[model samples]
Target: MKVGIAGLGTMGRVHAEAYRRMGANLVAVYDANPDRLAGFAAEFDVEAAASYELLLRQVDVVDVCTPTFTHLEMAETAFALGVDVILEKPLALTVEQGEQIIRAAREAGRRLFVAMVVRFFPQYRRAAELVRAGELGRVSVVRLKRVGFLPAAGWFRDPEKSGGMPVDLMIHDLDYARWLLGEPVSVMARRSPALSGQALEHVQALLAFPGGEMALVEGGWAYPPGYFRTGFDIAGDKGLIEWSSDQPEPLRTLFPKDEPPPALGLPMAGLEEDPYELELRHALAALESGGPFEVTPEDALAALKLALAVRESAASGRVVEVA
Candidate 1:
């Protein structure tokens, strides 16, 4: 498949590398910043499209790696041209825009894959698989944490652009929680005040699921520069599964004496391929085989709704009912 990347930023470069690794035809790339676009094109040996429109015309798929605010417009254009799209997370700044993108794709009859890379991470994928297979029978509680240093990009600090930390960062775990459990019935959240003249923020959200399942999801940009951490804890009637980035082991499981733990092979530390690359490969494979994407456009919209609810709950100091 011929692929063209939009937005020559960190994620844009990542997608380009993944496509190269997968041996896809990377025909073109575009960026608002000419210097970055030229540099990326030179580095990847791909054509630098004069504009997003030219890039759309050049490839079968357009990878929208631009900011959250730019997703809907770029996706709509690609869909209108009967080209598939791979959109980055938080699909859009608002649910309405996300729905519009979905509608455009439906009308265009093109595949719309949302890049929710968390779903591709080895440990997270294993946990979800085990939950679905009933290895973690009747799951009651899940705890997820994804905290890291503030992004160097100034746009990430702007609420209008990135939707703050909850919508931008926490949405990963929020989406994962929904994928593992189900749609959250309600969400209650708290966020640390953005310090004066500082962009750092933190949020902790409690999601109540329909079957009495609960998820404590937290994310932030309060860590020191270059610091990052993530982990998960899932508890159920039959067993418990845990994984932390700080731990030497990738995952740990405990089961009752009568119940044997499910067999799981861990990826070698520092040797596993990047989850972003895996996610892109899966998306392209689905596109080629006409299979379902791991993260559907509707799934992306649902995650956006939940993220918006988290923001609302944090601002209102009240539990927000998720529709």
Candidate 2:
């Protein structure tokens, strides 16, 4: 399928390349930055849209690759013009804006899929599969740890643009937790800014759900060297599943084998050699499937709500019930 991409920043460039590798034609491209646009056009050998309006006309799906601030407005305009959309994460800066995007898509008879690419990662897919199969019966606990250095620009160091870790990074972990187990009933969290209040440098959160299920999430954009990690330790009645990217074998499961200890399952398959390529394949698969991509718009909103709930809980210093 032909897809148009907006923005030519890091993500936009990666996605454009992903489309090329996946055999999806990059029919149109847009970027307000002249330098970025020219570099992207040179690198991809694709048509440069004279204007955003012109780009949409040549593509069946519009990939919203712009920043968070521009996402809602762009998605609304794209869907209102009658093309399906692939929205980048944190769905929107606010729940109201997210709802409006959803409303616009529904009213226009269009599809909206969020690019929560973690769900496409093989480790996560295996974890979710194990959880669903009851081999890890009734998952009762999840632990996610992610800490890393920030992007050089507005990705984290600018609250006005990035919304700090709660939006830029933590939301991914939060969304994965909710997507894997279920939504939490309440969340308690602490948020702290670094040397400057320009952005948050640390966050700690505890999510509690019905049936005694729980998650402890720790993440930040301040770190030494460099760090980026995900997946969790999942505990259940029949078995325990462990996932970690740093390990050679990212997933291992234990089950009672009627022995002194237990039986261990094989290691998880390697993750996609390239994530952006996997995203392109999944997006096209969804287009062919007629609905329900790996990341649904409703799931995206639910994840954003949890992130905002963390902000609310931290600001108020009280447990915030998810709406």
Candidate 3:
């Protein structure tokens, strides 16, 4: 498949490498930053498109790895040009923009796949499988967290640009939670207060789903420099499954000793496969087979809606109902 990536930042570089590893034809790339774009183009040995339009024209699909605010423009342009899109999550800055992207893709007959990479994480994927198979029978509660050092004075720190920690970071777990527990009916959230100049930001959201399922998703840009950690604990009537990045052996299960251990593959224990690669591979395979994306455009929109609800609740200090 012919692919192009916009934005030469961390995720853009990651996607480019994954495509290279998959032997995809990396046709071209475009970025607003000339120096970064030139360096990336040279490193990947791909053409540097002079404009986003050129990038879309040169590839069968484009990876819209740009910032949240730019997703609509990039994605709509790709759809208008009859190119499929691999959009990085959170799909768009708002639910309306997300719906527009999905609508445009449907009108243009192009596939729109949201790159919710957390779903492809070995541990996360395994956890979902176990939950779906009733191993975690009737999951009642889930706790998810991701905390990392705050970026200094950038679009990431700007709520208007990157949607802050809630939308940018917490959306991963929020989406994962929705995948595990289904759509949430309401959300209540709290944000750390009185931190000036975006020094530190943290948010905790409690989501309520049908059948008494609940998820507590905590995200922060308050960690020390170079520190990052993520993990989740899923609890149900039968038992619990958990994993943490800080753990030496990552995944853990607590259940009766007599029960046979789950048959998770080698990658689950070691994280041998990069989640980004796995995600892109799944997208490409589904595209080729005319199958469905694991994280559909609608699913991405739901996740974005849920994340926005969390933001609304945090800002207003009231529980917000998700429509």
Candidate 4:
């Protein structure tokens, strides 16, 4: 498929590299900043479109790697032209806009794949699979932590542009939690207030699911510069699974005494290829084969719903029900 990228920032370059690695046709790229667009096009040896409209006309698929606020407008334009879209996470700054994007895709009859890259990570993927296979029978508790240094991009610090930490950074685990435990019934959360000229905010959320399943999710940009970490601990009736980025092993599984442990081949280290690359390749293949995507538009919407509820709960100091 001929793909064109919008926004020549970090994610835009990442997607371009992935397409190149897969030997796919990356026809063109566009960015609001002309200098960045030119540099990226030169580096990738692709045409630099003068504007988003021109780029849209040149490719069969448009990858919207722009900021969270720009997603809906770019996606709507692509769908209007019968072009498929690969959108980055948070889908949109608001649930209403996310719904609009979904509606546009349905009307245009084009596939909309949202890049929730955490799902493609080996450890997280294995955990979800084992949960589905009942290796971790009747999961009772899940604790997830994703904290990192502030983004270099100033836009990320702006609540209007990126939906701040709760929506942008936290949504990954929120989505993954929903993927593991099913839809949450309610959410209660607490967040540090954004201080004057502060770029960091921390949030801790509790999600309640049916069958007494609970998830404690924490995400933020509160760490010191150049530091990032992610980890998860999941417990069930039969066994336990855990992993931490700070640890040497990527995954660990334990079973109770007298219970025969299942034979599972888990990756002790990270994959050779970037998870973003794997995610984009999967989207492209699904687009080509007319197969269902791993991260569906509806799944993205559900994740967004949960994230927004968490934001509300934190702000109001009350539990918010997920509709």
By lDDT, who's the top model here?
Answer: 4
Residue 248 of model 4, lDDT score = 81
Per-model CA lDDT versus the true structure = 0.89, 0.79, 0.88, 0.91
The TM-score between candidate 3 and the true structure equals 0.95
Candidate ranking under TM-score, highest first, comes to 4, 1, 3, 2
Q: lDDT tens string, model 1, 226-255?
A: 999999999998899999999987678888
What does the lDDT read for residue 250 in candidate 2?
56
Please write out the lDDT profile of model 3 over residues 1-323, one tens digit for every residue. 78899988888989999998988788899999999989999999999999999888888888889888999998888999999999988898888888999999999999999999999998898888888878866799999999998876488877888887888889999999999988999999998883776647788999999788899999998988999999999998777998999887757878767776555432444467789989999998888799988898899999889888998999999999999
Best by TM-score: 4
User: In model 1, how large is the Cα lDDT of residue 79?
Assistant: 87
Off by over 4 Å in 1: 263-271
Off by over 4 Å in 2: 197-200, 256-270
Predictions ranked by lDDT, top down? 4, 1, 3, 2
Error of 1 at 25 (Å): 1.1
In model 4, the Cα lDDT at residue 211 comes to 78
Candidate 4, residue 316: lDDT = 99
Give lDDT: candidate 3, residue 126: 82
Judge candidate 3 against the unseen true structure and give its global Cα lDDT, from 0 to 1.
Answer: 0.88
Q: How well is each residue in 1-323 modelled by candidate 2, as lDDT tens digits?
A: 78899988878878888888778878879998877777787778888887777888888898888888888779888887888888778788888988999999999999988888777767767777777766776788888877776776664465566666787788888988998778799999986756565353778899999778999888777775466666578888877778776777756777778633332244534554576688777887788689557778889899889988887887788999986
**CA lDDT, candidate 1, residue 68:** 89
Write model 4 residue lDDT over 16-110, tens digit each, in one string. Answer: 88889889999999998999889899999999999999999999999999999889999999999889999989899898999999999998898
Regions more than 4 Å wrong, model 4: 267-270
